[model samples]
Target: MSLPQPVPPSWKDLGKSSNDLLSKDFPFQGFALEVKTKTPSGVAFKVAGNRDAKSDTINGDIEAKWSDRKHGVTITNTWTTSNILRSQVELENQIAQGLKLDVTSSLHPDKSTKTALINAIYKQSGFHTRGALDIFKGPTFTADTVIGRDGFLVGAEAAYNVTEGNVTRYAAAVGYNAPEYAITLHGLNNLKTFTASYYHRVSSDVEAGAKAVYDSKSTHGGVGIEVGAKAYLDQAAFVKAKINNAGVVALGYTQTLRPGVKASFGLALDTTKLNEVAPVGPSHKIGLNLVFDS
Candidate 1:
């Protein structure tokens, strides 16, 4: 028999019941399973399909790793309906002087695309900085940089649209963090849009957050705000909700059924369109997850 995993009381701290976790859409609606096992040198990973009720298809990935204290290497393969779809390999190492470096390559058989990425990060004097480079089959290149410290973090990223053969978009963000809360300001596409968010833990079991967003190109062309809250009903269950100035509302509940088993339900509504000529109906979703250690 599997031992019962003791559930913790700090739901808000874990973001388990947090509505602010999602930026643009409702929570996922599917079932997933994962199993991990310890090897002599590293670990093995298996992730089963994130099965959706609407679709009867199943997919999964398997991975193996070899590692020690300083470095590791991993390889993975993914399959769907008996068809091998993708493969990926990665290598990472912590070099002398506290520098960490990693390289990854991936191939998608169905898409006829391949990608390679290299990155490095280093830390000193309580400061951290990192950079990355990506190359895809279209000969496209992208670069990113990030720097951060305890209470402050910032980053900038730009991507080359390989398919479009153009450098199209860029983004940046700055944030301040504390033990009880965090706030962030961000911009995308050279300030074509902006967003600001703040989150605070009201207590050990409850948390609240709000976000304000602006898009110069939107129909409204005005700032919109969203407020969210999460509360732990007990160690085994929790609920979360969010409301936005656009008259959109979302609510979710999660419950831990047993060790390695969990479930969730979600509902979303658009109050502004409830009684319109072409009424938009409410939406509901459900999900289940199972995890195991072999």
Candidate 2:
């Protein structure tokens, strides 16, 4: 008997390239800094801050996590501009052979919201199916399911507002995967909006992808689009670049400084904003990231 082949991991490589492009465009006002440390017992601690030098604005958060083979817990506390505290906690466990459960709670000093999620997966004769439910959040619920065989997948999801007694949103997706390339199409808000993506591995060291989104309700002149590529220079270094329909371009490079340390830098520019008449060379930004492990 021949064994079934598993899906290729190249899709993640494609996503990494896109994420490098999107990081600098975060809705937040400024650049971000993050640090993480893991202990021998699988406990981890993290801290992150976002700062804008021009505005002199900063936001920070701290998190801690502990995990074993089958169960995990995490807690995060955030400090907003008004110095108000918000905390979130999550717990996850594998309850049975193919079933998993997760619980999360978001809390302010005065009030709290809680949610529970259940996920299950099954596979047989080359077919796989997974289903999940996100329950009890402000009287809201989301249910989703996915099924796949070989290299093709389809998924549907819907959300309901219990208090309002209405279905708020619905979405669906279809995807196909092969050794060298993959594509997916997604529809949201009862098909009023759509997004599609394609990824391809050009060679052993190069991967490229593009994404586009459209919304029928919007009066925009053109679809939102982005294209990106990532290349591995060697075992220790890689570079990425992306350009969007809005005339903004970004470039990033990451390198392993040593066995347990890594560093990265990114720069972005909006070419359309640069002109003699505008008196601005370009709306440009730069960011750096460093990671350490013990």
Candidate 3:
């Protein structure tokens, strides 16, 4: 007999398809670029820079990582322009067959700010669990678990304030998965907010999704809806667009220039404000991203 496989996705990733389409590749207020390469010693390096037009400021960060596939260990460090250094170490399948552990720390040069966090995840056929603890700050503890079988999943998550001796947050989610589409429903913030998301792959090159959210704690208590679609123009290019109930529309186009280079363009406009007074420069926002990987 063949061994059964584990559940396809974890609780947090239940609605990732529609979420990524609606959230990713949206325009920003700045220009960003990133370059990644690997050295002969098997160390990976990434450098990223951003320039904000409104603030007229430039900032960047550099990250380096070393991984050992045989031992299942990885170490990474990042240095940012704000003089903060972050380091992380990850170990997989060291203690158990389906277990992973992560340790992360942050340090500031000029300030006394220091923080550390530890996380662990374990997965098996039909079950997944994760736990995280903050060591330096409130010393908070959080945990979540999901049980899945035959395309049905249910999960719950909660965070506790160790110092305060109280539960800070709790949420639950249920989902169903299929070959071509997935659907999920989540009750977050102690059941004060609810969200429903759906994703479908129409064809090999076309995809569509939608999400709806309702918040009982909001001042207006309204339901918000967003629909989006993505289509691959060809092997090297694709386009995405999404519109929300507030009349905000976002469009994105990405193209692979070469084997190691990619470029993306994004535009966003507020249709409700288009009839108002014209802005000084332009009434819409545009963003550009260029990436190179080797």
Candidate 4:
């Protein structure tokens, strides 16, 4: 008889569901748009722009990508209005099965600054691991790994500064994932902060999540809590709402306007300032986003 194969979880995706529920679709002081298309020669291009309401700054970037599936190689380049150029190249399943390699670099035209990094990832039935090294700057080294069996997962990550000859950061996480729900606990910021998160798929169209954070080094030294939920009204529209311990409430609505177009609206309000005769600044914030893809 053959035993059931184990599944390895991604270290970076430990609390992704809970994090997305509590953070995604929240309002910001900006308006952004993105358009994506592909060329006949198999090159993909994306143009993105953002307008900051507070700073009155308009920033944008243009990105292009080319992939060769036969050779298992992909290359991408992005140029930003801030005079920064970034590039990344990836190779998958070339050296060995379940192995991937990536090289990324960034250059600043005005400052004449350049930085590069190389990363490697390997994954198998029950194990996953990743490592990265900075070729410039402090020449830091970072690594993380996760192992899972029977829906239980454990992972750890650390980073070391080569120039300083010290371990700059370290963290650990444990999680359990089931068909209906997932729970995770994480020790972050070198163990100075801890967080617990839970996510549940209540029904076909309803999902809920919550997160609690405790900072040992904070002045308040108390646990902060946040809860959020998302519900799909129909095939073309959805709504999200969340509240935090500080009496801040946020709501978001998204709808598909057309076959290739979508729009999202967000609003945030401070309940604590409702009694104040006149709030010092804006007591509410709003955000809008639109996207087009072809």
Q: How many backbone clashes does candidate 4 have?
A: 0
lDDT of 2 by residue, 1-294 (tens): 656745222222223333434453332234566678878777677777777644667777766666555454455455544445555454444444433444444444444544455444443343444445556554666666555557776767777777888888888877777778777788888999988888888999998888898999998756999988888999999888888999987888888889867777777677876552321233766666666654
Candidate 4: segments with Cα more than 4 A from true spot? 1-6, 275-281
lDDT of 3 by residue, 169-188 (tens): 99999998887898999999
Best-to-worst ranking by TM-score = 4, 3, 2, 1
User: In candidate 4, what are the lDDT values of residues 1-294, reduced to their tens digit?
Assistant: 646646577789998889998887764556889899999989999999988766779999999999999999999999999989999999999999889999999999899899999999999887999999997968999999999888889999999999999999999999998888999999999998999999999999999999999999999878999999999999999999999999988899989999889888887778887754322347666777888988
**Candidate 4: RMSD over Cα atoms?**
2.0
Instruction: Please give each candidate's TM-score.
Output: 0.72, 0.78, 0.94, 0.95
lDDT of each: 0.62, 0.64, 0.89, 0.90
Query: In candidate 1, what are the lDDT values of residues 15-121, reduced to their tens digit?
Result: 22223454322344556676767666565555555676446455666655544544554555554444445555545443446456666666667667667777665
Model 3 clashing-pair count: 0
Report the CA-based lDDT of candidate 3 relative to the real structure: 0.89
Q: What is the lDDT of candidate 2?
A: 0.64
Q: What are the clashing pairs of model 3?
A: none
**Stretches of candidate 2 above 4 Å error?**
1-30, 53-55, 70-94, 110-137, 276-282
TM value for model 3: 0.94
